[model samples]
Target: DLDEVINGALSVLALEARAKGLELRSEIDPKVCTGLCGDPGRLRQVLTNLLNNAVKFTEQGEVVLRILPQEETSSAVSLIDGISGSQAALRFEVKDTGIGLSEDARGRIFEAFNQADQSTTRRYGGTGLGLTISLQLVKMMHGKIGVESEPGKGSLFWFTARFEKHAAGKAALAKQKPLPLGRVLLADGNATDREILRAELTALGMRCTSAASGEEALQFLCGAIADEDPYALAMIDMQMPGMNGVELARTIKNDHLTKGTRV
Candidate 1:
C-alpha cells in the first residue's frame, strides 16, 4: 500500500521532472510491504514533500525514491507497537543531486517552519512547513526521518516506516481482519468507497452496514437504537447528498440515543 501510494504520488511529478530535464526514478522493493496499517494519505504527503524538495533543489541528474526492507531496532520496536507485527522494517530514501546543506542548517531543518536558509524561501517559494509536517506524521506512525547532506555533494533524505507483512495477493486482502470496534456504520455518497470500507471493516470482525448519505445513516442509526442495537462507530463522508458529515456528527452528539457514539 505504501509503495502504491508513493508511485501514485510520484507519477504526477513525472511531468514536472521532464520539464526540469531531470530523471525521476523509483526503485521500490517488491517485498517492501505486503500490508500496512497506517494512513496512506500521510505516507503520500511525506513522499510528496521529500520528492518535491529533491526536484526543487536539483538542477541536473536524477532524483531517486528507493525502498528497502530492514530489521527494526530495540528502541524503535519498544516505541511503536506497530513494529511488533512487522516482519521487516521499511526504509524509504529520496536521494538527489542538489546544492546540499551545511552542518548547522541540517540540525534545524526538521524544526517547524525552518528551512536550510532564508534565501531558500525566496528561491524555492515554499513556507518551509513541509518537512515539519512530514516529521510529525512520521513520528505518529512510529518512524524516523533523517537527512545526510554535504555542502556540494547533494543530500539524501530518508525515513523508516515499519510495515506489517501478511500473505500476498487479493486473497490476502480478502482475509485481512481489522481490529473489531463493535458495530460500524459507513456513510459515504460514493458507492465504491462505501463498499471498500464496509469490506475492510467487516473483515475485522465489526458488524458493518452502509448508507448512501448522511440522512440514510441517521435514519438507520435511529432505527438501530429503537431496536436496542445501536452503532458504536459512524464513519461518514464530509460531503454527501443530504446533511454533511459534520452536521450529522453534531446531530448524533446532541441526540440522546447516539450521543456517545464515535464518529
Candidate 2:
C-alpha cells in the first residue's frame, strides 16, 4: 500500500520527466512489507518534494527512487531503523545526475526558502520551499533527510521513516494471490534436495538461486544486500555437508542485512 502511494506521488511528475527526455524510475524491495500505519498524504508530500527537486534540477540523465526496509540498532541515528519490535524502518532515496551541489548548498538545503545560490532560483524557478516542507514532514515522522553531492557529477538524497506493519497487513499478505516473490536463496549440500526445493518454489512463482554451502549463501546474501535486492526467503537443509541449517539460520538472523528474511 505504501509502495503504491509512493508510485502515485512520483507519477505526478513522471510525464514531465519524460517530456524533458529524462528517465524516472522507482524500485521497491520485494520483501518490504506493505501494511503500515501512517498518513499516506504526508508520506506522499515527502516523496513528492524529493522527486520534484530531483526532476527540477536535472537537465539530463536519470532520476531513480529506491525504497528498502532498513535494519538499524537505534531510532536516534535513523528513525527508519529499528524503532520498535512491531515496526520497521523503510528508507527512501532519490538519486539524480543533475547539476549537483556545492558543499555550502548541501549544508543549507533544508533551510526554509534558501537555495544553493540566488542564481539557483533564477535558473531553477522555485521558491526553495520543497526541501523545507519535506524536512518538516520527515521530522514529524521521527525521521531525517540527508544529501550527498559533488558539483557537476550527481546527487543522492535519502531519508528514513518508521512504519508499524500491523498484524492485519500480514494477514492480507497471506491472503493475496500467488505471485513471483522476486529472488530466493536455496541452500542444501545435496544437489537433489536443492533442485527439488527450487522446483517447488518455481512452481509457486519464485526465482530460486542455489547455494551449495552456508558460507556461499552468506556471500550471495551479502552481495544482494549491497545491490539492495536481497533474497526474500532462504531455504536451507537442516543437515548439510558444511555450515548446517541451524548454523546458517543463526548467522542469517545475527546479520542485520538478512535478518528480516524468512528462513
Candidate 3:
C-alpha cells in the first residue's frame, strides 16, 4: 500500500498544487511497511483530504508528508512500560507546516461537528468535514489521533495503527521498452491548441505536422500523396470555419491516390 496511497495522493494534489504555486514534497522511509492490512480506498481518501486541506489553507510554503515506522508498537510498549497487552494500537502521521491553531481551538478540532473558528473558515473555505472524516477513519482502524499547533506557526496531525502483512516477498515488476512513435497530422484553426498538440506529440517521439485549417490539411494530404509520406493518424477539430476534421478524414480515406497505398 506504500505506492498506492502515496501515488494516488500525489496525483490528486499535483494539479491543485500547480495552480497555487506550491510544491508537494514526499519522503517515505525505506523501513515503512509497504504491505499492510488496511482499506486502500479509505487510506487514499484520508490522504486526499489532508493534502487538500494543506493546499487550500496555505498561501505560501510547502506541504510535506513523511511516512516512517512507528518507534513504539503496542506489544513492545507493554514490555517497556510494564503495561498489559490491553494497550491501544499505532498509526501513521500526516503533518503540514501551514496555518497553525490556538490552544482553545485544538481541544475541539477533531470533534465530529467542530472545526476551526469562523475567522479561520472565512480566511479559508471548506465544509469542515475533512478532518472529521479523517479522524473517524483512523478510529475505525483502532488508532488514536492527535495534533500539535501554534497560532502563527503550523500544524502536525498524526495517527497510528497496527497492520498485518498479508503478502510476503511480492515485488512489482517493471515493464520494458518504450512505446513506438505515432505519425500524426494535427489540424486546428486555433494556433495555440495546434502548437500545444504539436509540442506534446513531438515530446511523445511522434512525427507530427500541423495545418491551420481543414483546407490546409486537405492540401497537406494532397501534397503528402504527391511527395509520398504516410500519416498514421489525423486529428482534426470539427469547429473550424471550413472543411472540418470529418471532411478531412473522409477526403483522405476516399482519395483515389491513397486507396491502394502502402506505407
Candidate 4:
C-alpha cells in the first residue's frame, strides 16, 4: 500500500529526526489513492533517500512529507508509460528547514558522487549517490524529479509519478471506520507544526483551533468553556517557548471549568 510505503520510509528515519529534536510530519491528501499499482520499492527508496538527507542536514526545525493528487491533464497523461486508462498522478514533496544549497550547488545536486561542496561531503559523510539513484529510479517509474533551495533558507525536493488505482484496495479503504467528529485545540510554537496538524485534523472531519503557545491555548480553552462549547480534545506540543504542554495540561486538569476538555 502507498500509505505503508510512506510510513515505512518515515519510520526508518524517525530516530535520526528525534535525535536532532526535529519533528517529522506527513500530510497526505485524502483524495490521493491509497492503493496503487506501481513500483512501491522504488517509491520507498526515493522517499527514504530524500528524507534521510533532510534529517542529516537539518539541525533544528522539522522535516515534512507532503503528497497530493496532481491534475490529470493531457500532458500529464501522455508522460506516463502504459497508462491505458484513468491513472492517479501524484506529487510527492519533501520539505526541510535545514541548511540549503546555493544556486550553483542545486544545478549539480543530482550528479553521481557529488554533493553541495567538499565541506558537505566531509561533514555529512555520504558518497552523494542518493539523489543520483533517486533520479534514475524516478525515471524508470516514468516520473520527474527536481529540487528547490536557497543558500540558507531550506530545500524542497519534489517528484511526480503516475500509478494505476487498485479498485479493491480503494473500496476497502472507503469502508474503514469514519473519523470522530469534534472540536480540537492544537498548541504548538512552530507555525508549520500547527498548520500541518490543523490541516490533517480538519481533513478528518474535526473543527480545529490553533494556538502558538500554551498561554494562548489556555485563553481559547477558557473562552470555549465560557461560551458553553468546550473543545472535545486538546493536542499540545511537548516543547514550546513558555508554559509548555505539561504545564498547560496540568492547568486544564486543575480548572474545573476546562477540566472536561480532553488533552
Q: Which candidate's TM-score is highest?
A: 4
lDDT of 4 at 158: 88
> Which candidate wins on lDDT?
4
Q: Would you list the C-alpha lDDT of every candidate in the order shown?
A: 0.78, 0.81, 0.67, 0.87
Better of 2 and 3 by lDDT: 2
Tens-digit lDDT string for candidate 2 (1-263)? 78678789889999989998987877665556788888888889888888888999999988888777676324335453346767867788898989888999889888887767878778986636888888889888777888989898888998888777868876776676656567899988866456656765775688889999999999999998999988898988887777989999999999888898889
Model 1's number of clashes is: 1
Q: Which of the two, 3 or 4, has more lDDT?
A: 4
Question: How would you order the candidates by lDDT, starting with the best?
Answer: 4, 2, 1, 3
- lDDT for model 4 comes to 0.87
* Model 1 stretches with alpha carbons more than 4 Å out: 72-88, 169-263
Q: TM-score order of candidates, best first?
A: 4, 2, 1, 3
Model 3 pairs whose backbones collide: 90-160, 90-161, 91-159, 91-160, 91-161
Candidate 3 displacement at residue 217 in angstroms: 54
Sliding window of 10 residues with minimal summed lDDT for model 4: 72-81
| Residue lDDT tens for model 3, 1-263 | 66777888879888888888775766554435465566877777777877777787776666776565455545224323432232223345555557787788789877654546788777676437888998888777655667778876877777665555435412321222234876678888866567657765775578889989888877766677678776677788876778876776677778786543222
Model 4: per-residue lDDT, tens digit, 128-217?
Answer: 789999999989877888889997788999888888889876787577664899999999998977887888788788999999999999
Candidate number that wins on TM-score, 3 or 4: 4
Instruction: Give candidate 3 regions above 4 Å deviation.
Output: 72-91, 169-263
Between candidates 1 and 2, the one scoring higher on TM-score is 2
Of candidates 4 and 2, the better by lDDT = 4
